[model samples]
Target: MRRHTIRPLAALAATGALALTGCAADDGTAGEGTSPGDGGRTLHAQRVMQLTQVHPQTGMTLLEGPTFDEEGRLLVVDVTAPAGEPKVIRVDLDEETAQPLHTDDRGAYTSAQFSPYDGRLYLTDFAGGAVVSLAPDGGDPHTFFSGDVDGAPMNPDDLAFDPEGNLYLSDSRGMREGEPLGRVVRIDRDGEEATVLADGLAATNGISFDAGYDGLWISELLENRISYLHLDAEGGVASRHTAVHVDGGIAQTDSIAVDADGNLYQALHGRPAMLVYSPHGEHLATVEIPAGHQGLESATNVAIVPGGTTAYLTVSGPAGGYLYSFEALAEGTRQSNGG
Candidate 1:
């Protein structure tokens, strides 16, 4: 398993905020913005909420799956917290407070999004290999979808919904080093069936629809890369190609969110920053935590509020889970929430 050990905050604070430049892949494609100090835009995020929960194994909390509901409430899941602890939480940005909404004895929910068709919050239980649902008020947790796909078990990490309410989730299981085992599965609107849109991925972690909803932007954590999959009318993969290959050093790519103009916000699991890329895979900007807030090193997921430029990031480390806010490169839409 990957290590979650927290490093010294003072050493991380010295780096300050960073501005990066994109690097070219071996195939001459735009990979990611790994070269720092390119004079790009650097925005410092302000902390919004801090969770007090801690995981016994890792000695710190890990947050992911940030999304905003139609009512503009910020929701996130604590992937490291155990049973009896708050596994899911709602944050009050103005008041800087959090409320426990759900908990489970064996569920390790890695992502959460509200379905457009059903108006219910859906969570991807990574540990249970199932998709769970809850009422808007975070009550009545239900098992929305579970079971094997083609005789193979699932390990869902993150999920997103299309305008028509079709569910798409990332299966992170079957990863075997050079032998990729991750896949993107699309469940029908009614949750009666599922189709594998793309497969042979390396630790698929994030999934989001494009601005036009004709394609999907997927992040492969172990590969440190992103891919764009053009979808056909039936939601099958029409064409797929590498998008952004990030060289994160000790960090790995986590959840991602897209802006209205097609800018992708890629979050890093072990780093204290987020890298923004244009639709064409061009590096746009780097959003980072300020010096004093560098203690929160796990910048794992981001959610941009629809119709607004404000972006909220879910970060956690030794200090605990936290929500931070920064300005995005473009306005956000429903695609901006939950990946």
Candidate 2:
């Protein structure tokens, strides 16, 4: 597996148009953050300064979903422009290079994760309204799940599995205006059954679990809120509740990541910041993004390096994107259900 250290920067100063402030190396005391706790003082994140631009400035690939393969390589989807074709690219951190993987026909990929049960990459094929799997080397792309369960199209967007080896998916009708129809769906660990866990969601974009697996978190884009669902032992939603609601400012949250301390990092797609929340859903901090793809305010997803000390983010638009790594204020819990 590949290992990476944060490439050195002269200082943590904001470069160019990023304009980052109020965050720098502190005494590490700014965070009296507890270990795996459910409460704490409103903590500030150490400014997420860019590690390096893994791509060029005038780029042309809109990036989605960040997943790390078993080899510790970063994988992301390119919702390619013009025809909306989808592709996958593997980024070698040690070499600081990206190589497009050869797939027979990936179609439209929106998000992906490495499954712990099978150790393969599972992805959302948006155009086909299905989920597909691929070998870690990006070979043998095949359909994993597709079609309807309760009459409507699955229209899977983003996905996450649980500690029990069960799978979860978000069926966002579309990221459209006005009230939208969306829901969270689940697949049993045996992959033999499908169930809709919750409904009436709007633009459900991202889903995840807390450090302790106590709650399942989802970002409803059009609804501008992150909902937490209490899951039954088999990984079905027993109860659902709102974790955080964005009343104003960058309400279209596209994705999220949680650290080992239960700190949630949300990707605000319409702005240049990472929204932070406490375990109990209280707003805590904001990490400024220096810039976006060709001025497009879309921060896609975040993943941590194996050592847990750094976080890598995929942020970009059709004009191009960059993989940025930064020192995190807290350590992260690796996906127990995803290899």
Candidate 3:
């Protein structure tokens, strides 16, 4: 297990004060932020798909999860799509086309992941408070986990699976107004058992394992903080600490992906960009849309395909939903594949 250490206040300033320009110094020299426009080594993401008409009931769309199936096709979910509209979409990168994979009136899936153990797709339903599963072909849909854990209702938002195939979920209950009812849950490989690994979080939105699988990185939307939970041999949290905390920003930290080199790619909710940070919380780079494409500001999640540095981000807002691509900091691993 890696030991935790407190970073200097300058490093904290580099992370919290997002307006400053330049990369963070490992020696705590305090330079921070990339340039406002596209110059400061900003990776201008290219659009891959257009989902302008996905949501009929609400003109606005919210694309949350972006994961690659075993066959390397991109899969994402439309959280704002009403009943009778397609919620799950599969994108073919080679063809640059998207098609609906699943639609159900009872589901408001916020994230989708392909489980490593069963080789099936699993989705987290935020509104329905359940985890659902299906084959990659979108057949034989089944509820993987539901109801309550520890006698408390849960709103499952995002999920991750450990190397052993155990599932970890982020329960985003009571997070809209910053309520502290959020929780982290763990389920067995077969989905027959569940446990509340941690609780009392304010809008636990995204969950992902680190490069080493030694811990988990959790993003809290309301607080704009990333908490690292060091895990023991049994996948239990042994300790906790804030790894990244950005203060006074309209951008809410949403979904995150970890590279094989331990760098973190964090998607910003209100801003059309992704923040790259080192494992020690050093600000690395800001991947954003080009200057003219400002309409795509509601970036939500990121998915880096396994064994490669190519990464895709999910964004939605006035221009509807979009899939953007950029080069990742390092080669993607199992930790980067989902949620």
Candidate 4:
């Protein structure tokens, strides 16, 4: 985890507001800009909102993992610090007000999700190797999972839940030593123990179930690819295959979100944009921030809004990044069609 003192909220807000203003000016539009795509394609983004800075004071930061709550509010984790405390924040989309939901001194919170079934927030702690469950009203947080589950060392990174209430966690085992492999662990509602569902992956960072809950999609960050694992009758992986392969040395995928139409969006760490792929793994397009934009230094995580027309991306940086909003384009809609 990275370390930095929390600044005053007012200061952060001012900085973010200024950054958004600058971005809007550079694009020559109040709410839209053009983005580049592969094979000379182009995408257009109509900016719905721009959150420039995230901090306890500013109420947003380089957002790590983001998801929508039952009431449609956006929840995101802050992972700006390489060490020390981190925060989880909730942004009221209608009001545009960000409020700190939870804070932990153990380490940076990397990813987060809101369970519609139970209305609890599940967050992953990277350095601390734990999964925390917070109450919906911002009550005390409790540990859902910790290090060394079932005697196997765990470096828990990201997670997703199925309709049956089973939580699937991604453990990037042994990452710091440069030999990080991937494993998927399933924790039932009873909290009895952790069970490894899949193992020996090349750096898995994100996982999400298909809308039908019959298949799982995982992001292989180091390999710059996505894989689909077919689930068997017991809800375990029966077989797996590569779904997509990203080119151009932009392999550090951090988080992923799926829309109603089955389109997939991936947050590319170290790259300045998000990659969009069709369900068949074809590279559909790329979404980029305007060149002079200040908020998007490193696009890390993304969450599709409930209606599927908006995507919120977390930008990682020292000065704190923003929770940027981009309108989702319709299927088969070319960039020339206002994206």
Candidate 5:
């Protein structure tokens, strides 16, 4: 395992203030608790390691989600200032080197995911309010779905794909001061689009589907709750409900990931811990991370590898960020249950 350390910004600005208010030091132990898992099972998560920093080739201002491609290379979206010039960075785990995958000339890119079916990458442009599809080899980006769905630019945030190749995105509306309410959208493979989903939400940031692909769950950063959109037989979102809500003042719940057993893992943006939830939206435990490195002031994204035994977390600091891997102790339980 490699360790990198970076420094946090001097001022306790927006990011720093949020971190201080949300996280409290723990005994450095993996979260211990039991919650209802998928099909009467129980789920748990322990903190294996805390990565101090990640070294990017070029400095990234605000980094968000990280997903792996077929080759296991990590692709991350960097949404910094200069508005129209966000970048996509690829990190090689084997060599510990980072390279630019793609750069935007139109707007800032926030979250990104790789399409296994087409091998293309799909990303959300917060400023442009659209989703752009780019070639994996890095080339010109095509407008897969621009939220100009009724004339106005729909504020697109994070996104996830279903088994049928349709992309489900979150359109966080209330961000521009006085605008429409936030809603979830679905885009077809052929570029055909529909606002099949809508909800009265606040800052709908990260989203993910269940392991069985039967329901969709989204993180409401402003409201501090995880919202659920039940899936129908036709793969359409049929209904909506609240999955989980944090009781304390830690409201900045941003990105989320799911284990093989259908348990949800989310990053408490304002806190240094990762919150784990059961399929029924029950808070099971919190994976506490020590506060030694700089970027640790903010933990942005959480991801579980395919085997379900390991997890990757992104710790963002002032200079840059790094990725940390954690080993899941209950790996055999998830594997045996076909998670």
Candidate 6:
């Protein structure tokens, strides 16, 4: 299924037809037996909805972010979706409706995270090498941070925040080739500047802070490993270690999200699947995308609803801009500010 030109907002605005088909929520949920109290890791997942199938007016070959706001709206971004069409969209989880919010001609966009404190959306422009931001209503796009140290390009992939309002980003300068130029950075409480936390990485990808703010995880794409960062009292990286290192030609790791109990849900590349691991690097469960589903190829990042047993995913590939919800066995770690 090559990417198609589905201008959903334009089509919906003209013809009041919002095609939300092929979406159903099932009772069988994931993480049923896999719980923190049980002292074990391993869970199952049941598909709830295939985004494109539910709303067939989206075309994206590169889909990534799936962050939600406190208002129950999920912010989804596409990179050169429909070939050179980069845009940010919002989906009402309550009503199951989709709408385009903003479009950028500057460069390919990768991720957009809604900030609770500032009431804005933080975005990563892969080609332009900058961290931009905007209002929740998709207004006033401006550069929040740009450039890089040593006068190099800023190739940021994913972003995460700590309990104290510090921001962390994975800089994938040369990720595709697994170059060691990748790095992990952190911003201060005022968001005025960023400092390098760790360097000499191999295509650093997704990132997530533990629920307790005790650890931070960074994905090393092409290397099939997830780096675990031990935090000091102030949330700085005290020690860095590889928590989940997949070998035997398994798969490449992408974005990651953490649950309340410190369970990490990671997306795999070589195939469409989700791998859950315990905090101790214990292999918990592998959730495989159902075949013949609406959109399963190129499954990338995941956003688990807080206190809700559901994990919403953003998938791309031949058919892009797909959103999915799966039965999660546990609750996701909520932000300190209740975002």
Q: lDDT winner among the candidates?
A: 1
The local distance difference test score of each candidate is 0.78, 0.62, 0.76, 0.62, 0.60, 0.65
Best by TM-score: 1
TM-score of 6: 0.79
TM-score of each: 0.88, 0.77, 0.86, 0.80, 0.76, 0.79
lDDT of 3 by residue, 9-38 (tens): 112222342111111111111122455643
Instruction: Provide the lowest-lDDT 10-residue window in model 5.
Output: 13-22
Comparison by lDDT, 1 against 2, better one: 1
- Colliding residue pairs in candidate 5: 54-321, 54-322, 260-339, 295-317
Tens-digit per-residue lDDT, 1-339, candidate 6: 323433212122224332221345645544544544435444454554444432223334556778777777777776554322437777787777677778765645667776545767888776666888888888898888887755556677788876555678887654333336778878664668778888878767778887777877888875778888888886677998887786515456777888877777787654566777777887776665554654445557787776776677776555444665665547764531111
Of the pair 2 and 6, which is ahead by lDDT? Answer: 6
The parts of candidate 4 lying over 4 Å away from their true place are 1-41, 44-61, 81-86, 174-180, 248-251, 330-339
- Cα lDDT tens digits, model 1, 87-200, are 888876656567888987778788999988989999987766799999988899889899998777777888988889999998875444357778899998788998888888
Q: Write the per-residue lDDT of candidate 4 for residues 1-339, one digit (tens) a residue.
A: 222433211122223321210122233232433334454233433344444444443233556777776677777776643223337677887776777677655645667776646768777766566878889766778987776776766656778877666778777653334554568888775556678888777667768776566777787766777888899987788998888887737337666766666667776766667777788877766777655564345677677655446666666554455656566653211110100
Q: Which 10-residue span in candidate 1 carries the lowest summed lDDT?
A: 17-26
Q: Where does candidate 3 stray beyond 4 Å?
A: 1-40, 175-179
Note the residue pairs that clash in candidate 3.
none
- Pitting candidate 3 against candidate 5, the one with the higher TM-score is 3
Winner on TM-score (3 vs 6): 3
Clashing pairs in model 2, backbone N/Cα/C closer than 3 A:
18-290, 59-319
Which segments of model 1 are wrong by more than 4 Å? 1-35
Kindly indicate the candidate among 1 and 6 with the higher TM-score.
Answer: 1
Candidate 5, 1-339: lDDT as tens digits: 212322121111112221210112224433334433433222223333222223343233556667776677767766542423337777776666677777655656667877646868888877676788888866878988775765555667778877667777776655334433667778776678666476667767667887777888787766778888898897776888887876526437767777777777777665555666778776656665544543454566765555656666666655344555555433312111111
